[model samples]
Structure formats: C-alpha cells, structure tokens
Target chain A: EPEVTQTPSHQVTQMGQEVILRCVPISNHLYFYWYRQILGQKVEFLVSFYNNEISEKSEIFDDQFSVERPDGSNFTLKIRSTKLEDSAMYFCASRGDTEFFHFGNGTRLTVT
Target chain B: AQSVTQLDSHVSVSEGTPVLLRCNYSSSYSPSLFWYVQHPNKGLQLLLKYTSAATLVKGINGFEAEFKKSETSFHLTKPSAHMSDAAEYFCVVSGPTGFQKLVFGTGTRLLVSP
Candidate 1:
C-alpha cells in the first residue's frame, strides 16, 4: 500500500535557525495535514492544506510557520525561526475521498 | 466542534487476559470515530474506524471498537492481550468537514505483561 513518507526522521537545529520538514503524501490523496505531539502531551493539529492553499490552521501555527506543496508530490512545512519549544514529533497525514487519515512515522525535531 | 476523551490514561493487562480502553466523544454532527495505536517510536497506525456504519467495528490485529451513540462512547477492546499490544492508544473524532481534521484524545497507554 502507498504510505505517506516523511524525511529526516530526526532533525537537530539551533534555536534561531530555520527548518523545513518534508512529506510525500499518498499519490492520490486530496488533503494534507500537519500535527505535532510534544513529549508527554496530546497530539495537536497545526495546519491543513488542500488545493495548494492552507484551509485552516491552529493557533500554534503562527506566522513563523508556513506550508507549501512546492510540487505535485511534495508537501513542506517551514518554520522561519525555531524555538526550544518547537521540539516535538511532527507528523504528516493525508486522506483521500474516504473518511480516514493515514499518518507518517513522523519527524522528531530537536532545537537546541 | 469535535472532541474525544480517553477515560483511562493507563491500563495494564497480563498476556491472555482481556483488554479494554474507554473513550467518549462530543460532536455537533454525526461523528466518524477511529482508534489508532502507536508503538514506542513508531507512527500512529489505524486500528479501526466507525464511520456511521455498523455500530460494532472490527479492526486489524484482532482489535475492535463499539460505537454507542446514546452513550457517546467508542471503546476499544481485545479478547486476548499480547505482549505486542503494549502501546499507546488514541481515540479520534473527525472534524465537522469530515476527515479534513482529526481531534484526538489524550491517549491510553496499554501495558501488557507476561
């Protein structure tokens, strides 16, 4: 089965550096989403994208964050300036016509 | 709006014993519910989902969940626990626009012992 894929399973960066997390959603899915789970906390939604634009975003997805399709197969999330609190397991998910979302293994971001 | 609550934060079971993880949900419209499992460092794997089909839904890995609208609950259960079942379980409800967004419960940590 085709699965959503995320790169750089682990990322380490300085507090003020910029970072871009990458994901390749299932080939035929129409919707893409980003979620993150801080250690010992519940998973929180960051943003949702469709038709090449952001449809909705949570408060956590401030101006520092942005998402782009870039191409037909890749979806990227960029954080302009990282903070120590940005450390978390970021997950990418996609869904087709069905009412189910498939998730990727996740990218563990660590900001020092 | 949609939300889910996992009644138990942690549940322990011995191999060969039955297992249960409770969940309750609140949704403005008819909801689509799902159960996901996560191993220590792995991604969330779909266990099963209740999409207004049969009230009882069976999923992969011999796991199952029942949706009771009157109770607003969707609880996960397994007849026999296995060591491999030791993981974190989350109960999720689809957002109003369907699967566009998922609201997840805090999660229940299942510990299976021999």
Candidate 2:
C-alpha cells in the first residue's frame, strides 16, 4: 500500500532557528494535512492543504508557520522561528475522498 | 463545530480479556468517525472508520467500533487484548460538509497486563 513519507525522522534545532519539515503525500491523494502532538498531549491539527493552498488552520498555526507544496510531490511545513513549545511530533497525513487517512511516521522536532 | 471526547484517559486490561475504549462525539451534521492507535515514537495508525455506512465497522488488529447516532458515540472494542495492544488510542470526528478537518479527542492509553 502506498503511504505518506516524511523526511528527517528527528530534528534538533536552536530556539530561534528556522526548520522545514518535509512530506511526500501518497501518490494521487488530493488532500494533505499536518498535525502535532506534544509529549503526553493529544494530537492537534495544524493546517490542511488542497489545490496547493491552505484550506484551514488552527490557532497554533500562527504567522510563524507556513505550508508549501513547492513541487507536485512535496508538502513542506516551515517554521520561521522555532520556539520551545514547537517541540513535538509532527505527522503528515493524506486522504482521498474517503474518510480513511494514511499517516507518515512523524518527524520529532526538538528545539532547545 | 464538531468534537470528540474520550471518556477514559487510561484503561487497564489483562491479556486475553476484552477491551473497550469509550468515545463520544458532538457534530451538527452527519459525521465521519475514526479510531487511531499510536505506539511509542510511532505515527498514528488508522484502526477503523465509520462514514455513515455500517453501524458496526471492523478495523485492523481485530479491533472494531460501533457508531451509535442516537447516543452520538463511536466506541472501539476488541474481543481479546494482547501486549501489543498496549498503546494510545485517539477518537476522531469530522463533518462531511465542512473543510474536512479532523477533530481529535484527548487520547485513551490502554495498558495490557499479563
């Protein structure tokens, strides 16, 4: 089965540095999403993308966060300036018209 | 607005015993419900989903869920628990007509005791 794939399984960055988390969604999937889970916390939605544009975003997805589909296969999330609170497991997911979603093994971001 | 609520933050069950994880949802329209499991340091795995199809939906790993509209609940159940079943489970809900954003519940952590 085709699955979503993310790069940099784990990352460690300085508090003020910028980082880009990359994902290659399932081939032929139209919708893409990003979600994060703080240690010991529920997974929280960050943003959703379709047609190379953001469909919706949560409060956590502030100005510091931006998503781009720079290429046909790559969906990237960029944090302008990383904060300590930005440290979490970030998961990229994709789904077709159906409700079932395929998630990539998350990228663990650690900012110190 | 749609949301999911997991009644229990943690559940402990013995190996070979039945497993139940209670979940309730609030949605203004017909919703798609799902159950996902996550092992340590891993990503979320879709166990099952209910999209106005059969009320009883079966998923991987011998897990299943019943969608009860009257009760506004989609509870996951398993016939027998295993040590591998010990993980964090999340209840998710999404409206059919909206932006297709999934709302996740505070997860329920299942611990299998031998």
User: What TM-score does chain A reach in every model?
Assistant: 0.99, 0.99
Q: For model 1, what is the C-alpha lDDT against the true structure? A: 0.95
In model 2, where do residues sit more than 4 Å from their true spots? none
Each model's DockQ score: 0.78, 0.84
- Fraction of true contacts reproduced, model 2? 0.84
i-RMSD per candidate, Å: 1.2, 0.9
Please tell me how candidate 2 rates in CAPRI terms: high
Model 2, range A1-112, lDDT digits (tens) per residue? 8989999999999999999999999989889999999999999999999988999999999999999999899999999999999999999999887666789999999999
Tens digits of lDDT, candidate 1, A21-97: 99999999999999999988889999999889899999999999999999999999999999999999999999998
lDDT of each: 0.95, 0.94
Off by over 4 Å in 1: none
lDDT of 1 by residue, B1-114 (tens): 889999999999999999999999999899889999999999999999998889999999999999999999999999999999999999999856643699899999999999
Tens digit of per-residue lDDT, candidate 2, span B45-101: 989899888999999999999999999999999999999999999999987754597
Question: Per-prediction TM-score, please?
Answer: 0.98, 0.98
Worst 10 residues of 1 chain B by lDDT: B94-103
